[model samples]
Target: MHFTRPRDLVVAGLVALAFVYVAFKFAYGSMPRLPTLAGATLIVLAVIEALLAFSIRARIRQRRVTSALAVVRAVALAKASSMLGALMLGAWLGVLAALLPRVGDLAAATGDVRSALVGTPSAIVLIAAGLWLEYCCRTPEGGDRKHDDHPTG
Candidate 1:
């Protein structure tokens, strides 16, 4: 899979922000409050992916791929991470945009905005982690590929 394009993410976030801001303007009272743990959970995921990326890249760079299965697994993780990061980034931006103007005026908006603010950075971290993972899959310059005579099972 290819690395995510920044422009696409930016466009997605903009569209989501516009949509959510309008919807929240009318539904703020009825909408449920943002969960406080959301940010923490995303942060945890981001950290996990970041560490995983670093470890996997190190192995790849060293030409120490253990098996075909492992590389396949890493590829799958990279694909999933990139997609999730993009989606979460857009969603969080949307909610944050809605809450911006109302932060001090309403208690719900205030709390929700805080969570969104926390989530935004975490989501960005996830994106960075995902992209790093994708980059790790590429063979380094001048690396030998003699062992890859056959695709790993």
Candidate 2:
């Protein structure tokens, strides 16, 4: 199913807004041991990517050029966004991985294996969510490939 430009824009806007809100909350809220700095950085990057994706989608809808320029641009933006998302996910996972060992140590000290395992899902979920978002942003519309194959008259 094809999504309209307005719908894409709305979705991107909402995503960006949500990220901005989360970043703000992370930066200002009082949460002990929270990955506030990393969260804020990831949110900011996501906001930029969502906006770029929205812009590329808008340009593609215009159909002003039939030389596959729009497709190329969209693909480039999507790749960039995907890379950033991956980087953010990796950084988040790294933080969690680092903390996990410490938590494991604490857990061992207290004989609490469950507590150590509890945070494992946090990393897993973060990676999964990042992959989902990357997939969503990277999946180009069907027409994009057709445009790439067609010669510009």
TM-score per candidate: 0.79, 0.39
Error of 1 at 136 (Å): 1.2
Model 1 agreement with the true structure over 38-149: per-residue lDDT tens digits: 8667677767877877888788778787885776677678767766777777777888777788878898888898888887888788877777776676677834243453
Question: What lDDT does each candidate get?
Answer: 0.74, 0.42
Best by lDDT: 1
Alpha carbon lDDT of residue 130, candidate 1? 75
Query: What is the per-residue lDDT of model 2 for residues 50-143, given as tens digits with 9 covering 90 to 100?
Result: 5655654555456444555554554555544444444444434443433444554443322222322433343334333333333343334553
For all candidates, the clash counts are 0, 0
Question: Looking at model 1, which ten-residue stretch has the lowest summed lDDT?
Answer: 142-151
Tell me how far candidate 1 lies from the true structure as C-alpha RMSD in angstroms: 5.2
RMSD of candidate 2 to true structure, Å: 13.1
The deviation in Å at residue 65 for candidate 1 is 0.8
